[model samples]
Target: MNNRTGCEDPYLNYVISRRPFGWNFTDPPVFLPFDFEKVDPFYWVSLMETNWKVAFYAAAVYIFVIFGLQNYMKSRPPFELRKLLFIWNLSLGIFSVIGFVRYVPGFLFVLNQPNGFYKSICVKDGMDVPTGFWTLLFAFSKFWELGDTILIVLRKRRLVLIQYYHHVVTMIVVWIVGPLVEPIARWYTVLNFFVHSLMYPYFSLRAIGIRVPVFIANLITFLQLSQMIIGFTVNMTSLYHQQIGNDCVRYPISIQAFSLVYGSFIFLFGKLFYDSVIKSGRRRTEKKLL
Candidate 1:
């Protein structure tokens, strides 16, 4: 790491140098039983590494349950679990917001260093800090998010290919790559938290019968597409660095896998945006003329 003072900011300097692996908050306001400062992130890392197979098991169960439930619900009235949906989306939105807050500062701090952009994408740091704690939670949350498919199935909503594929692939990838603690993993975590913060809250509003503006819905899809584009770009850049023998850009296989996924997302989300926004708008216009 470069020897510059961390912008005269004590917190930033502490985050950069100390890289402490525990919560920064104290008990007076946010009271918890254990010592927040004493928590070890590596313990969680080891735990995740050992239990990575659980993601596959969960995915298998998830596939079986979603299809089975869809079949079972075919002859029944759709359940309107509006309250539960509201709660689920709201909880995830709040979690994502907190994650985004925790992650962005460290990410920005690293990005401002010398060759910061490259280092941010290449150097694996911050895995032993509070950020890592959130990253682990984010990975684990994928299993919880599989419940989304259940909601769709129960509601008799059409679960598109991208929906389940995205969930299962993401669950597997995050579980496998999360333990590696690659620098690029921060990029994935931060971008995902940022997107989900907006996404789940939007779902919350709709779940409770709020009529959100059409443009806002379109904007969310656009943002999702943009996120995929950025992710693809990041992976490709990392691959380029690795090709040129940049020692910091570790984990070539992981990068390639991520690149493939994001590349596919660009197509899937783009088609969704065009079909829902552009094509729908044209149809509405033609109807008005008719």
Candidate 2:
């Protein structure tokens, strides 16, 4: 009955402990804000914690909508499957590489002085530690990701359970952690930018018409797998070092949920990719030889 079995459910623990500071959730003439100082960080993350129900409907709704539209449109030019598919895969591929690449400079920024982010980028600073415009831009990117699912639906593409779940959940989780974990967010962002850079380009290419070199897709998957692996490794290492009374970066929650969510996603998708790519390729070669 417990969401946690140990004291080490990082995200659960950190999010539960978060208290609010003064910040606006949305701005403009109707600047809706929260008294960050008055609210508990726990409440904020809990409230925004990826709404799976909404996300589920969000994931499925589009598929059906497209199905109906396709049906009604009669001979609707067959959905232009080629170009759209290229863009989709191209985006995912480029995003992966770009995200990783972006992490490089930020890596140096911390290397010169260093905090735990050097090891893992999921660490957070207190609420006011704004690194400025670019940081906020990264924070807001979470919103843009909602459009990703839309792209899937519009193109009438198959939605893998893991892909659908991963995209939606990650978008929400990252947003939740973005503000909460600021210390090494730059590392995570740059890594993500690198990933996105590669990811988007891959998707674009897939959309336009090109079978992505299998290696590129494999590389993206490998990179993602590494991210999660590193995430888990760093969390436990930090946890261990902290236990030993050493001064480790104290952002456990980011890693906790990260390990849980991303770990599962990486494993699931990795297996999926391996099965579809490697195994299938092997089988095809074997069949040809026979």
lDDT of each: 0.78, 0.52
Model 2 regions more than 4 Å off: 1-78, 81-103, 112-132, 249-252
lDDT of 2 by residue, 1-290 (tens): 11221234343333323323322121111111223322344343444455424434654664465456545555543356665556555655554454344335434544454453434433332222122223444545555565565555555566566655666566655665655544445555655666567667766776666688888887777776666666556556666767787654555677676668766876886787688777977998999999
* TM match of model 1 to true structure: 0.86
Give the Cα-based TM-score of candidate 2 against the true structure.
0.62
Query: Could you tell me the lDDT of residue 282 within candidate 1?
Result: 94
* Model 1 CA deviation exceeding 4 Å by range: 1-38, 125-128, 288-290
Give lDDT tens digits, candidate 1, residues 235-269. Answer: 88888888888866457668867977898889999
- Residue range with the least summed lDDT across 10 consecutive positions in model 1: 25-34
Instruction: Please name the candidate that would achieve the greatest lDDT relative to the true structure.
Output: 1
